[model samples]
Target: MTKVKIASTTDVSSDKVLKTSANGKSVLVAKVGDNYCAIANKCPHFGLPLAKGKFENGVITCPFHGSKFEICTGKNVEWVDSFVGIPLPAIAQKMIAMGKSPTDVANFAVTQEGTDLFIDS
Candidate 1:
């Protein structure tokens, strides 16, 4: 695995996310308590930058489509709900999806050395 240095632990607070790149892939690094997590910065649903999304608890909600994902695991918690904060009906969601389905975002392994943070890409 290629260990790419993303940022220093001090650079990312528990409430903030640090955006970086590794192996030509945009990555988002965030700290949860004493552990650190690395995941794709782009939302899988619409390829929107997740840095502009909301991060709460352990989930990040896409700003464009409202798709929710688990930060540490990159698991798809919820599919597209609406654009921005507008609520979408079930019919609208189905129409928007057509035949597509929500997929999990890519997650990278994170490691810390001293105060520096590295992501395995």
Candidate 2:
């Protein structure tokens, strides 16, 4: 478990992204109040760079498809049995191996100390 310094407290503003490295993997950090939170920079749903998106009420909305995801939870904004409810414009995709879901493949984490954020790859 490696911890990398991604940004200085003065660098990222609340609701912004700061890229970091922990265990040789790219991670995304976001400002929440006076503290910072980190998560995988790649979107679990579409593998997009979440750093280019916006954060609102602890959730980050993907710019590519406007899909909302919980930064702290790393889960889709809404769901019911492997289905997405949001109508945001999205790219067509090959379905997940039937019955399976995106949540099955996502394993993002968020941690912080003061204004510094950390992630585990």
Candidate 3:
């Protein structure tokens, strides 16, 4: 397993997101209590960095297209109850479900350990 020591537990506060990049892909680090949770850094919609997006109730919205996703899994928040791989007529819907209108996910690998993060292939 690959591990990157990002920061200490004190560096982040509960409910706040600390974003960084590893392996050229966006990495989002969030502090919940004394532990850190890491996930993909970019929004599933429009490929916007999740760091630039807003977080609320464990969910985040893409700034580029108003698409929302769950911060932990990078999956669509499902406001309209749509599937990730499905395409809708609404542009905003597509963004939320697929991260971009033309949803072709560039797969990457990432993980976290003891407040540190790692990006592996």
Q: Pick the candidate with the highest lDDT.
A: 1
- Global lDDT for candidate 3? 0.54
Q: How much lDDT does candidate 2 score?
A: 0.58
- Per residue, candidate 3 scores C-alpha lDDT tens digits across 1-121 of 4445655555655666776666565666665444455667654444556567667766665554555665555566543233343435565464445443433223233345665454552
Worst 10 residues of 2 by lDDT: 88-97
Q: Give me the displacement of residue 92 in model 1, in angstroms.
A: 0.8
The estimated TM-scores of all candidates read: 0.93, 0.62, 0.59
lDDT of 2 at 12: 67
Query: What's the ranking of the predictions by lDDT, best on top?
Result: 1, 2, 3
Q: Choose the strongest candidate by TM-score.
A: 1
Candidate 1, run of 10 with poorest lDDT: 91-100
TM-score, prediction 2: 0.62
Query: 1 or 2, which is superior by TM-score?
Result: 1
lDDT of 2 by residue, 5-120 (tens): 66666666675677766676666666666456667777666576767766777777666545566665566763222224234222232232233244411435555567654555
